[model samples]
Target: MTMVENVRNGLLIGAGPRGEEGREPWFLDPREILRTVRLRWITVLLPVLLLLGLAAAWTHLNPPQYAASTQILIDPRGLQVVKDGLTPPDQASDASLLLVDSQLRVLTSDDVLGRVVDRFDLAQDPEFQGRETLLGALKGLVARLTGRTEPPADPRLAALRILRDRTGARRLERSFVLELGVTSEDRDKAARLARGVAETYLARDAATRSDTTRRAGEAIEGRLAELRDALRKAEDKAQGFRARHNLVGTRAQLVSEQQLTQLSDQLGAARAKALEAGARLRQIEGVLAGGPSDSVNEIVQNPTITALRGQLAGVERLRADAEETLGRRHPSYQAALVQEKAVRGTIQAEIRRIAAASRNDYQAALASARTLADTLERRKADALKVGDDFVQLRELERQVEASRAVYEAFLVRARELQEQQRLDTSASRIISPASPPEKRLGPPTPVVFAAALVAGLGLGLVGSLGLELLAGRVRSRRRLEGHLGRSGLDALPRAPRGVAGAGAFRASFGTARGDGSYEVALARLRHRLAAAAPGQRPLVVLVTAADDRTGKSVLARALALSAASDRERVILVDTDPKGLVTRDLGAAAPRDLPATLRERGTLGEALITLASGLQVLPRPSDLPRDLAGRLADALLRSDADLVVVDLGLVGGNVVTERLIADERIPVLLLAVSARRGRLAAVDRALKAIGAGRRPRIVVTDVGARD
Candidate 1:
């Protein structure tokens, strides 16, 4: 078999399945960023060195600042002299934090710092009399321009401002310890200022406490006087009310109530006496009528009544004896009878007297009871009349008691405040006094330089990344392939300077050997093509670029020569209306391609053959209206094993668009690796060709690989 037939059978293969486009797994690729930094190391390093130098100079030229710090414990509840104070002490954690924060503010307040300034006599010192700042100078300049005069600054105020600017106060985290720090150029001044601030803060706090106590004591004293007057008035009113109502008695009861109670008792006693006397009188009367007088307890107990009864009994016995012994009228019996009769008469008279006495007693008792009842009734009326007055008097007395209570409370508070005014105490005390620092503030020189170096390197790295993004060039093969979503793409090195335009094309696949980079790249491309689509006869390859002057025509001619050198039937067609490839290959024809097509000429009549046995079909100067149709017809009529068409500057014409749209025809997109926007241009070309089409990319003018 011939070499052409061998190549056709061995090299031509059907296209394999394409890989699926993958999403970037990571948001940012550190390796790619590092590669970009490495590529532009000079851009990154310049800023780093510059910053390092600047830091070194700054550390050397600037004077060191000395700082001194004093620590004070803020305890609002400490050294309390009284139970109730002007400011209540807070014990909650959040409240304590807020209290400490407030103390920190107080430590830096003008009240404390102003005293500090006076104690140190900083108003006259040059250190405290600082120079005008830039902003102040600008203000002064503006005032002068506007013909306005500013008042002279007070030296004390200026010193206070300077002290406030140079000093700082902060509370330790999660604690009540406040640290007051002062910075100055002079070490001794720094220490003095720190100590002065602490001392002044303590003095101010003590003075505030003492003043608060004094003011509170004064206020309590005034309130106590008012309360005393009110108490006096309340007592006077209560006494006057008591006098008017006659509601007088012991502490417990009023006189009207006591009198009414005594009257009621007497009335009961009188009524009982009257009932007893009436019972005795009735008993005596019964004895006089018919019943036994002995049954009357009063009469029975009377000595005279008892003796009479005995005499009458003796006489009656004598009379009975006389009546029985003397039948007729005898002198002795008559005398006994007369005696008995006299005794009986005496007993009766005694009984009658007793009964009269009982009746008198009954009448006296009844009268007494009636008088007592009348007196009690009058007492009750007086008591009822006094009830309303008593209630009013009690209300007045309650007011007096309330006033007295208030007066007493104020008196106690006043006494406590009076005692507190004598005591000198503060809420915070200095735990650590300020001392002159051994070293300066801020970091050491070596540390500063190291930090500067790191900062400059970071800045430079950011700058380099920015420049890389702005340039937008393809630097890595993996990145190019990843961006295009295909593999097996080729990158060709820049041609040798010794070889010109046509010579560079000829050297790509001709027998004349030159640089190995371009030739080796071409060979790799051919192998990739053979692997890309195997068992495919008469393969159509379209060579194009995003923009003009990207060596697409040269690449197309090289591809054709490569296949022709392999003894394969190859044809190179120029579809560019400019006929750039035709002029470059020096292919001249007797007739233009469109005119020949219009006349129905044979493909050979318009074709130009090179010494390498590669046929060329050049484009006309003016493109035909149906360029895509004509190109399709020409491609159909061709009998070559491999047809290479140079569709110059993709998306420039409808013919190129139609050719790219055809899936059967594979596209070879030429890209300049060094050109900005090259990737974006290639992406635009791919999108125009449509998403289903996967074009083989060739990155040209690449530098030497590592």
Candidate 2:
């Protein structure tokens, strides 16, 4: 069977009587909610109209604010014209973000804002002076009512506060561009202020850069003077050290060292000359001491000696001739011998003279060499004595050179800084200047109205739900289902008043003249019962209520009539001890079901057939103890295609409970009026029936009773 059928037949109450496991709760019905909203539409419209009127008045009383913005590009590369040991601009993501943030702070800083304020004389502007606007007036009134006083503020401070509030700066996403904006009541003023802020910031930045360069140059120049003094002092100390030590020197050599070198050269030449003279003296002495004069090259090569040797040979020849001619002393032979002797004597004198001269020359050379050696030794000692002073002089000269080098470096830097001061410019520049805006700041009037409408509708829906909750009535099928914890079958209209006995049933369920809504409700209930069974066996529909006045008997008869009109065999059983079905259907002298069962042993004998072909089984005034058994037997014996039992005021009798407990039977809970206590009783009845039997709730007398 389908879930709906199972629920109707009380086969799956664990899933909730209304099959609410996967279904929306009955109270959430959109149509019902809309109906509630329609009933209290004024609640929604009031808020909408009120908000719209307030928006209109606000717009009329207050002047529109206009916003103007200027764009600045923060390019670090712009300051690359001169490098003066300043930090280079970074373009990496992290560095760029930091630089942009720092620049943004500077752009909105008091210094930049102060310049703008001074340029525009904003301290005198009425807006900046805190003139009483609508909001300001409201604040003042509230302050007065609260008995609070505010201290007077300085004009400059007030102008600064207002300027800061109206001006803002933000960097464009992932870029070096910044957008500075200003808002004011006057469009021209807004544009001018925006431009003023941008210009002021740029000018301040440039001035800061130039001033920084100038200060750097001044510092370098000051340091340069110190270095210059240090260099001069170093040079003077070197010169004084040299003078104090008597350490005189050319750039490449000392004076004592030069004298020592000259003496060393003179000593070497004198020693060489002495050795030559001694060698010549030895040769002459050897020749004089009986060595062969002719063997000596010096004596052999002498011109006087050579001539004397020739004369000696001639004199020997003459003497030999004289000895032979004249016997002992011939005068001519004697003359020849004398002449040879004289020539020999002359040769001997010349040799002795040359040897003497050689000795004298050697003696003079030895004396000169000895004197020069003595002078050279003294000069070397003097040079060694001044070695420490020369070292100190070199250190002083090195210090002077170092000082000069440092001075030159600083001097170069100072010049560069001076040039930088001349060319200094800001890293940021205006990329797009501010212009007067055509439209005001905030949303247009129509958009505000639409927003108010939506807000009003939402509040209206909330109000409707609250009102419905407050009423706490089951006025519709959905409300009935929600109240009873079961699916609603149908909502039957109340019968017209003044119709008594069977006339009420005729007016509600008459085939030709019945109320359309009541008849249609009955037909719908009949169809639901047929659908719930869907079997060849007779469909048993039990109609019960929490209490009387629920019109359960009337609904049971109407259901039977609606089925009979469809050409189906329908039996209307009134199981109430009050005989409500018999009285309402106008069935005269209805045989008691139990008595008929005891006498005839068949429910067919007790059934009263109506003119509409609907059979009725009316209950006695007092129910018998075995009434449940007799009713079951009577139902089995009958051949009706549909059976609708009227069990009035359920939970009041044991027989009704026993009949409702049957799982095969579909029960309809009639709810004519919903009260908190009555709903509680219905809930208790459902729980007592157990999850194995779920009943369908039928709301009757809907509009008229609720």
Candidate 3:
């Protein structure tokens, strides 16, 4: 499709229903378009704002000056001539448009503006034409600073050019319409410039008409002289022919006399011969046919005799056939011979009849000769009577030729005059005239406004979408779960309550109802623990976290419920000094490591039973070089099939490190969202925990979706 066709098709289709199966109504669905626009709003608006700001600044800071125009309308035929009409001469539409554009160039030319500058003495101005006064010098200094007062063109031409550049003068497409526009801060100046163009057009029109008419007259005069000379030559040839041919009438009369004499004699002789032959032929034919024939030609001319001869021939053939059937000496043979003889005699008689008929034809020729003699005498008399009248046609032909010459000259002159009149109009027609444009032609305001609005919207969308694309924050649930390397058993939203509700995990983990948040998390963890190492003795599950406040105590409680809820006794340990996990889960504050070691009991006695089947033990407040001191009292979950111990944050710095390290307890790694749950962080924590033996990695605070 052509560009125009595509544009037209788009317009037509845009106006029609544009929809697809299972989609929103085309025009009404702004979501996709709006989304794209929002994404680019900032990109589009920034440039628009710049343009608007520049426009505003220009309007405020720049002093507006008026632009004027002076137009000279030329016929482009190079006629330099004028014709009828007060308006500019009418021209072909295309030619007229060309003239307008050419005029535009001429108006902007430096030569023209130079004249205006010199005439106006513009160099003496305060800014331009003024003399070098203090104000002029100050303005010059300012111009130097701003680089404003620079011109490569003549001032007058520059002025005109400024006007022309701001103005529009063009013929309407394919029509006899021309408009001129001049824009200026001074409306009167614009009007004056436009009016001046019309004035200039009028002057041009007059000069062109005068030149056209004058040249036409001269051309016609020159052609007419050539025609006159040609006419003279034709006439001279006719005159010379007449002088040379003095025999013209004589030759015509002689030829006519000769033809007349010959025709008269031949007519007389033909009549005499026809009569003599008729009498002689009658006598001969009468004797032969046994009757006095009116004319033998009449008898001989009849076709019946020839037909009878043919019949006789057929009868002879039949007789011959009879002879062939019989013998030569028989009666049948003799009879056939007799019949053949009779038919031959009849043929001889017909020949005699023809000979008798022609003898009269000779007599008739003699009679016709006598008759021709009389006719010839009469024609001779007629020819003698009409003397020299045959010569008149020759003189008449000369007169006709002379008249044709005169007519040809007159026709030539008339055609020349006709052609001159036609050239008179065609040679100097003005293609277009000057008039103010009703609507100014320039950068369209509505388009500019629409563009700016779209640009602004686009810029805003761009800023928003760009930030989204460049961001390295939380993305989707899949990536979050991938970091954990396990199922996201449960999750929490960003709640203001923090970790206080962790006691529910403890309660859910076979703990008392008063210990709320920790019970819930523990129950989930306990379920995992029971499934992971089912029906195993000394099923110790060591818990550790990446950082503080990651619900380690709660996990231990939930794990304990999974173990002892089925009548299995379970022990819990908090190796974190801060007791953050214990406090959030409503457990008693943890004691110092040294205090536990100082007790009479071993590590098993350090555990405090919070409910029927669950017990809590936390990290110590003092230092213990070795947790092996408490290992002697290490509490075994005799009443439970599983046990969960909170090893707290991983590292040698933590007090629980050696308990797992030296004792070789099975450790479970726990990570939380607050400590940056990314694959990199997970890998780092994995590496740290892997320093001793591999630990089971678990995650906390992963989200769930509908």
TM-score, predicted candidate 1 vs. hidden true structure: 0.56
Residue 549 lDDT, candidate 3, scale 0-100:
40
Candidate 2: tens digits of C-alpha lDDT, residues 253-332: 68888888888888898899889888877887887776768666667888888888988988888888888888438897
Please report the candidate that would top lDDT against the real structure: 1
The 10-residue segment of model 3 with minimum total lDDT is 9-18
Reference-based lDDT, residue 589, model 2: 38
After superposition, the stretches of candidate 3 with alpha carbons farther than 4 Å from their true spots are: 1-76, 80-104, 110-471, 479-490, 494-529, 536-572, 577-579, 582-604, 611-614, 623-669, 674-683, 686-706
Candidate 3, number of clashes = 98
Clashes of each: 8, 1, 98
The alpha-carbon lDDT assigned to residue 183 of candidate 2 equals 93
Candidate 1 vs candidate 2: the lDDT winner is 1
